[model samples]
Target chain A: MVEPVTIAVDVMGGDLGPDVVLDGALQALRADSALHLALVGPADVVEPFAAAHDRTRAVAATEVIAMGEHPAAAVRAKKDSSIVVGCRLVKEGQAQGFFSAGSTGACLAAATLVVGRVKGVKRPALGQVLPAYARPCLLIDVGANADCKPEYLVQFAQMGVVYMESIMGVSAPRVGLLNIGSEDTKGDEFAQKAHQLLAASVPQFAGNCEGGNLMAGDFDVVVCDGFTGNVCLKTIEGTAKTLFKYVKDALMASLPSKLGALLVKGDLSRLKGKLSPETYGGTPLLGVKGAVIVGHGSSNATAVANGIAVAATTVRANVAGVIADTVARAGSATPGGEGEAAASDAR
Target chain B: MVEPVTIAVDVMGGDLGPDVVLDGALQALRADSALHLALVGPADVVEPFAAAHDRTRAVAATEVIAMGEHPAAAVRAKKDSSIVVGCRLVKEGQAQGFFSAGSTGACLAAATLVVGRVKGVKRPALGQVLPAYARPCLLIDVGANADCKPEYLVQFAQMGVVYMESIMGVSAPRVGLLNIGSEDTKGDEFAQKAHQLLAASVPQFAGNCEGGNLMAGDFDVVVCDGFTGNVCLKTIEGTAKTLFKYVKDALMASLPSKLGALLVKGDLSRLKGKLSPETYGGTPLLGVKGAVIVGHGSSNATAVANGIAVAATTVRANVAGVIADTVARAGSATPGGEGEAAASDAR
Candidate 1:
């Protein structure tokens, strides 16, 4: 008899609001018998789910954070907000993980402030597992710290390595620093310094990986500052969407192409599935004390359910604890290990 | 009849070297009777083209800059190099423009140092005309100034607008500041400051554009620092290639899908053409005293021809003189215009 992994779900988040969130939570609960969910929202919104499932619990909250509101300010003001309360549940040890398809800024804020950072971790990076040609690769700091130092990237690499090893079950993950070019001398002062730091610190440091080779599947983990990473991720998504739209428009331009499109409909659907963010479920905010999964703001029911599953799996794997250990090991391996330890302690 | 526009071609540049360059130069000369080409390279490589075409002239250059050589060092050391000599021809009024399908770094260095910068222009930006949903958009600073200040971005926007309006024939082009978020307060310190400067200076400023909206055709000109713009451009190219590869694999997986692919071959070719970098030919190095066009290193004969035609069109339109005038007007339009002019004079 294994104990069920409990996860807190923010029902009042995302663009779709509570109804879609509640439905997704219910679907997730039904799919896994060893899974438990604490649906946090207004009483009316969450009470129905709590009453229906034996493994589900309702945690009432009155306030909701708007997507456009300043994240830190909103989190600070709305203590009873669904996002904040859900994270608080994880902080209190009532849940092993927290899941939200909400305002990304709000989720990041609450997760870092409420659930807290793992010991010795300077910043928590938002990581996404994206499908590449050969296999899936993890990209860290998709939108966490936009202005990052070389030391911060080193930490991001360590966290990414640990997450890939423990959660994705990859041994000795190859870490690549994302830069403008593959050469060591490429990029600006920050990227140059970061490359040197990563080369000295990380065990499986593969040199620089250009943005063009990101989907080539040559790297297991790619580390970059949030600004560049965010642009890279969104560019991929946008270009994919635009390309498909262009193809569809081209196909429907004439009768022969329309017939061709009909024949390959199944293949196209499969291709879409491979490229869809929902297939990967949710992105994990690593280096936090508790497992935190942030889904797309426009995620559907399937995506939300998958996000919950990811949260449960991450919690079961104890990713937070593993990340802490990995960062500590990486710190001790460097010549300035003692200084790094002292700085972390001071923080 | 209008007087013929003379442009310099780096006959020894690109992967295919002199053969493809000479062939493409001949094709351009044949296509446009009013175009004259100065083929600059070793006598053995360029003399044949000069002898074959009445309008083509051969200029002897003894040295070639390899793609891997350090850009500044190569430009300084190889005084008789084809790229340096080509730019020198343009600088000395023998040619109105210079074109190369060779090392981008070398081209940039030679163009900046030899061709010179427009008066009052701080830095030259590399601008590429990429296809969007509705029309083509000009992306500036693709690889010119990697680490750019906010003022540099403002200049880029001004240059991008002028290029799009005069060359692409867009009236009052909408300028967009490329950032991770659409909000004014949503980027790093650099982006935030650049946004403010652009909003105040650019007449058709469209506010901040997220990476995802880059291909949506919502803006006519998108501006970013060289690093982010380079990454964004490469990411798009890489993603498009990967997606097409994925689609081809999916189509060939089964007989029926393969048949469907055959039926849509024409449509597929059209889609590929729409996404091909070759369709746009070359990226113009804006802000230089003379027009300088940089083509892809892997350019085929047809692509090379298109690049030469682009150079001819840019020269005919007097893009460099117009850019200088636009910058002078923009500098004076701002309150600190006198100080900027003083700084330029000092430089």
Candidate 2:
């Protein structure tokens, strides 16, 4: 039999509080027989639950990081916070992975500083699976390095290819450079330089993919600077919500429409379930030395459970090790070790 | 009675060619008795239409700039092209404004190089009216000025304020700095600096606006660097299209759902209309010495007519003069003429 995978869960992280996280952790434990959980939180909050559950232990964390606190400073100062403790568990090899639905910035900071980065990796990026209409697409650097150089995007594409291939079973995943236009020289200076590097370095490089084509599933992976990708991701969410709300208001305006809404409600709900962020669970912080999933702040119990499963899956795939080896190989293949040079300057 | 307003229409522009633009120009003439049109295109295409319609005249142009051509090069090389000639009309004071359903890049280039930027304005920007669920919001720098400094964003907000005030009749329009987070110090260096400038300079600064709040109608004007703004605008369109397509497919899956779709078809169509880009006519290229509207390349005849009407309205409102005055005033007010120093470095 295979060894059981252990994941550290930060119970103090989301808007819904520890009760919801504890319930989700229990649900995940029940679903996976071989899964062990390290519940990280305040002593009183985690001790009783750990004692009552099998294959579980409580890791007491004395401090709590507020959502509004500065990320780097908070992670540095709040050494005993749940987020930091959870990362420490991964660093100490007590847990194979970590999951949290807390402040995304705080999670990123803790993961980068505490868990450390993979060897030769410049910067870890948040790679999220967007629910595209035709098929799911992975968008990298969603909000990690907002001010990115060309080489950073190349690394993001490489890491994304690895994750999609290993986890999503996408073979030779087609990659596209996200830009303002489809032309090779469409975006600003950074995009232009990135496009040239992507075409040269990435074997599966497709031409530029405009924002309108992001959800069309023309490319399996899309790489962009974190700022643009973040805006695009949020814009997609806002658009869907706004459109659906308008549709509901329109349906209620007439009797026939109201009747119609009832008849198609189930089908529409199913479609929504397919597109919901809860299905994806969380965004993986790729290039970190250990698996770390950043869940949405408003995630429910189901989403939290899904996030735990994702962390386990990521551990099983050995994503961090694969990334480290691949990046080292790529760096050696370059004429003058450009990748290492770039990583040296990384934050 | 007010004096007649004349707008130069690039009949050769757009996917459908001169036929749709000619028809729309004719329709606009019929709808408003005091509105005249200068149809700019090849002799064969515009001469007959102008001869057949009252208050319409054909302006012969020997060349046409295709969509895929480099914008700046095409505008310079094809000096007699319909797009260039249309801008030339505004430059020579033959027409009050220009409208085109052609290449956005070409339109932006011609407007900047030919019609020229307003004195003291660093860069002219494209400001599109977004069909927000609650109300319309103006998004500036949608595609122009791809690489923007914080000062350029300040100018964009100032220009947006003038356009929203004069055209949309918004009083003290609320301006927002588009960023990844809502916090004052959330985004990268550029966004943080832009937020500070916007808050200090804009009277109705609404702080940092996240992507999710874009269409919520909390802010009347949202300003971003051109690259991010373009991606956000296109992402919003893509998401709306993708979601509706999914809804339609879901509704067609079962017999009852199909019936429901039929019943709600009219109401849904109305909602779609309310969210459609065609309804917005065109995005105005703000901060130019003369008015220029960039219509969607896929614009139909009615959309073309709407664009022309928008350009005429922009001219009537003296938007160019208002922006020039506001920017000039803001520039002089700043210590040590910071605005002028920044404008000198603009491309």
lDDT tens digits, residues A1-347, model 1? Answer: 55589999999877887788888887898889999999999999788779977889999999999889999999999999999999999999999999999888899999999999999888899999987787888999899887666678888898898888877888989999988888898986667777888899888899998888888888899998888889889888988999899988888878888888888778987999889987888899999987899999888888899999989888888889888888887777754433432221110
- Candidate 2: residue B135 Cα off by (Å): 1.0
**lDDT by residue for model 1 (B1-347), tens:** 75689999998888986889888887888899999999999998788768877998999999999989999999999999999999999999999988999889999999999989999898899998877887888888888877766778888988898889888899989999988898888887677767877888888898988889888888999999888888888888888989999988888877778888888878988889878887888899999977899998888788889999988888888888888888888887754433432221110
Please write out the lDDT profile of model 2 over residues A56-75, one tens digit for every residue.
99999999999999999999
Per residue, candidate 2 scores C-alpha lDDT tens digits across B13-112 of 8898788888788777777788999999999888888898888899999999999999999999999999999999999999999999999999999999
Share of reference contacts found in each model: 0.62, 0.68
TM-score of 2: 0.96
Clashing pairs in 1: none
Q: lDDT per prediction?
A: 0.86, 0.87
> Candidate 2 DockQ score?
0.56
Model 1 earns a TM-score of: 0.96
